[model samples]
Target: MISENKIYFYPIWLRIWHGINAMGILILIVTGINMQFSNPKFGLVNFELAVNLHNISGILVTINYLLFFFGNILTSNKRYYRLKRKGLFKRLQLQVDYYTSGMFKNQQPPFPLSEKRKFNPMQKVSYLTVMYLFVPGLVITGLALLFPETIIENVYSVSGIFLTAILHASLGFLVSIFLIIHLYVASIGKNPLNNFKSIINGYHDIHGH
Candidate 1:
């Protein structure tokens, strides 16, 4: 006795890439933590093991990112991340209001899912920033750190490798924060696990789409 609509958004390739990218990012986070904080108090993996796992995860993430980059370029999925400049702020504000206040009051969502609109304004901005800006930054900085010899010897009076390591770690922290927020937001759909199931099955349970 259910009549909810469904839409197929996640293609097989995208789903595969997502699975690998997620696993790689998680492994990188754990291994990065071990390397960054080697204290026996909270650290689980040893430094050497952490370094190895971190490097491997970084490589996997980099490769997966390239797949995502080209996949967007070669597929129709890129439209979801495109920002429509017209009414951008208004749309963003409306979605923000829904998240912050409206949803709490049991109000309907301002921007519901549709065939043409895969994401709201806020999601488009965050996804674009994360996938394009932050992921690339992380990949480049990670590679520089992985091969210290490729790094510049000095910048001003400070070590270039030191700067790269700091930037890389900062990017990792930002990505970690984004991941946490992403997980929490994913649960805000039809049910706690609705979006999670969609990501796995390639079809989102929508309504009136």
Candidate 2:
């Protein structure tokens, strides 16, 4: 199958959600850092302000995530996240090879973007794990911290809030790192900025597949 160079990849609703989620994540990371390393002279945000902003951003992100969750279920976009079990390991290896060696040596991607597949093997797995597992875990921990009464005071002896905070911070850190990798990967392709623009324009410039 063949088509034009441009493909409408991100729909308007998806784009809006993506934008809001991105902003919320950025806010969370910044405020999280400020809160973690509280210092009036050097902190990027006031401790009180940071706590308020982090809570608010966390709530917004949670709501946005729910929307994204339902949107995928209600729309055809879920197809892109679906996994094909056959040759999954081999496909992941090839995609990893392409990223580590092939791309720099002018080799085509093992899994090029297409009307049917928005993600490569690695992307699918990473996205699935992050969105489904890490994200929900983060949201649950965040909500627990936001409302401590809902959780028991201790977990098998350790303070519940302490454990919850540690888990929340750990998940937040991993998600932040994922955002960094996501940006770097998005910056690849013929024109680096084209990938970034595609989200805004809703049309990705596909290299012939």
Candidate 3:
């Protein structure tokens, strides 16, 4: 059980950014589904309206991600990947093993969080790729779709808007899959509620448990 004396951890900016980004991604996914299927299942909206909203939300999500990125940099928070210690590979291996096998046996998590290092080995790799690589790639492709003509005129050999649209959708699908896995793992915490509470109330005190 979490001790009452455990302090709150997450800052206000992280909380706000997380909430907004979640909403924006949801909107983008829903609209994307309707646009892709082009069916009455979701009562397809006007094409122009859907595209406009997608563009705006895309911008918002990109900006929110940036806020999260710089927020971490400015703080004393050492990113997961920055954890400098011997047995880095061993720690990562144990983390992967726990996720794949130990978790099913109800084993306790191998890595705990602190002010400097808040993410586990898996989280470090996942978040690093998502933030530094996939997210920026998605944003660039989305902006290309939003303004195809402008992009085509400036860039010589870059694939056209059609390709950009396909790339963006592919990245979106990948991100959606990651979200499903993330949410499920989150539910596996001490009380299930503990994961949710930590994000909202901050600190997660797994003192005795």
Candidate 4:
């Protein structure tokens, strides 16, 4: 149950989308690592199974990403991710300082989470890059890999598959790094579990808000 002090931070669509997106990304990450390494002793699943799971999860995540994109637009929730043109660098610097220095001292964030601006400046930039740029790049490259004979051969004069594979693997590595940072920061809210709980239940306990 949500308490009076808590504010509704996530809507139903966002919650559902986020849940599916997170699960799909996790599955993709695990399967991707297994497929990339191909070490039988350390395999989470067989190589064939990993490939099938990765493809399925990637497709599902792409669909969910579209849902998130359209849902935010329809609901006007995309504003939360809009970066402020004015003082953007300053805000980003402050946020960086807070994370690197202040956070260790238990200092409050420079830009606290709120109903209006759910993300800080840094988050806005990072999330925007990830959602709009990185995700689309990954999806396109993944699709090319999926239909290599049809897409890759015609698209590139030579080494199309190799190039596509490099791009896909590079993006996957970047997404994994981003996920690690995201989970670490999510644990740094008012309480260790505050961010996780908010995502799960929609209610966020903003201290003194």
Candidate 5:
């Protein structure tokens, strides 16, 4: 068993960013799927509507992402996502074990949430890769598609439009998968709604750490 303590885990700006980012990504995913698999006919919106919405949402998400980037830097909150080389793999293994095995037995996490280290080793690696690498690639590719005339010549050395589309779609697919996994894992907190509630109020109930 673990004791519980309430901590201000998220700040107001972070909460706002999280909410906007989630909504934007969800919209993008829906429209992206619709555009990719138009024959399925399960999309909520038509192809033309989906394309327009996707473009608008993509632009808004880019702005939101930029805000998140600068906010993290200005507030120094980026530290939470940093990965240290020393003992990282070992820590990642422990985290994986906890999630895959120990969690089923109600074991406490090896690295509990704290003010200094908000993310575990596994989370640090995953979030950092997605946020910095994957997201930037997605944005770059999306921008290239949006302004093809400017980039077509520059990228002509490679497959150009075809390669850009493939890269964008691939990154978007990965991000969609990540979002699903993230939601499921968020529910794995002390209470099913604990993690969700934390984002709304900025207070997370810390248990066992």
Candidate 6:
């Protein structure tokens, strides 16, 4: 029989970070949509307010992410981020196989949890990429928009304001796509609310390495 013991998993800080991050991303998405479709002659109805709110939310998200980074360090959760010697493509392929075939055949997950490495194979790739690539990219672009003067001073060779705006919008769209996929995948736990409950109460009763 499966164990039913309540084991501590996600900590309170992580729960707070997750909730805040989700909300911040949602706000950004709503504002982004409004800004994208604004009618210029409508007297700055959606464009002005949406862009303002989005920038505020971006600032909050940046602060929240820094706190999350510090929390991970304090809790020694950085071990989960250490990549294995195995190649990224190989590891990704293995995870894909497990999800496609093994999961349906009662086979165990290829890469399971431990005190050190709690993330599964796919999570290792996804979360790491989000942090190192997506989040940083978005933050940099947002900051450039927030302080065009300073940025232009630093990088005099920049293409132009319009080019920068294009880049920022592209990254924001990518983040929105990731958020949707992440939310859908979060629902695929032992139960519909299993993952969410784990984040809330810090326990998920499952076997792992």
Best by lDDT: 2
Comparing candidate 2 with candidate 6, which one achieves the higher TM-score? 2
Model 4 lowest lDDT segment of ten: 149-158
Query: Model 6: what TM-score?
Result: 0.84
Q: Can you give the TM-score per candidate against the true fold?
A: 0.93, 0.94, 0.83, 0.91, 0.91, 0.84
Error (Å) of candidate 6 at residue 147 is 1.6
The C-alpha lDDT values of all candidates are 0.86, 0.89, 0.74, 0.84, 0.86, 0.77
Q: Give the number of colliding residue pairs in candidate 6.
A: 0
| Candidate 4 per-residue C-alpha lDDT over 1-209 given as tens digits, one digit per residue, 9 for 90 to 100 | 34676888887877998999899999999999899889868787899999999999999999988887787788788789777699999999999998889878878878876677678888888899899988888998998888887554534466778788889999989999999999987887777888898899888877621
Better of 1 and 5 by lDDT: 1
**Cα lDDT of model 4 overall?**
0.84
Better of 3 and 4 by lDDT: 4
Clashing residue pairs in candidate 1 (N, C-alpha, C atoms within 3 angstroms): none
Q: Relative to the unseen true structure, what is the C-alpha lDDT of residue 37 in candidate 1, on a scale of 0 to 100?
A: 79
Better of 2 and 5 by TM-score: 2
**Residue 67: error of model 1 in Å?**
0.8
- Please tell me which model should have the higher lDDT, number 4 or number 6: 4
The best-first sequence of candidates by lDDT reads 2, 1, 5, 4, 6, 3
Candidate 3 C-alpha lDDT tens digits along 1-209 = 23564645666666778889878988888778768776544546766677777878999998887776786688655454575558878988999888889878988878866555567877887777777778888888887777777555333666666567778889988888878887877776667767777778777655312
Give the range of the ten consecutive residues with the poorest summed lDDT in model 1: 1-10
Model 5: per-residue Cα lDDT over 1-209, one tens digit each = 22358788878978988898899999999999989888654767899999999899899989988987887788788789777799888999999999999988988899989787788888788898889988888989998888887566535467678888899999999999899988988898878888998889888888732
- Model 4 lDDT at residue 31: 93
- Candidate 4 stretches with Cα past 4 Å from truth are 1-3, 40-42, 154-158
RMSD of each: 2.4, 1.9, 3.3, 2.3, 2.9, 3.5
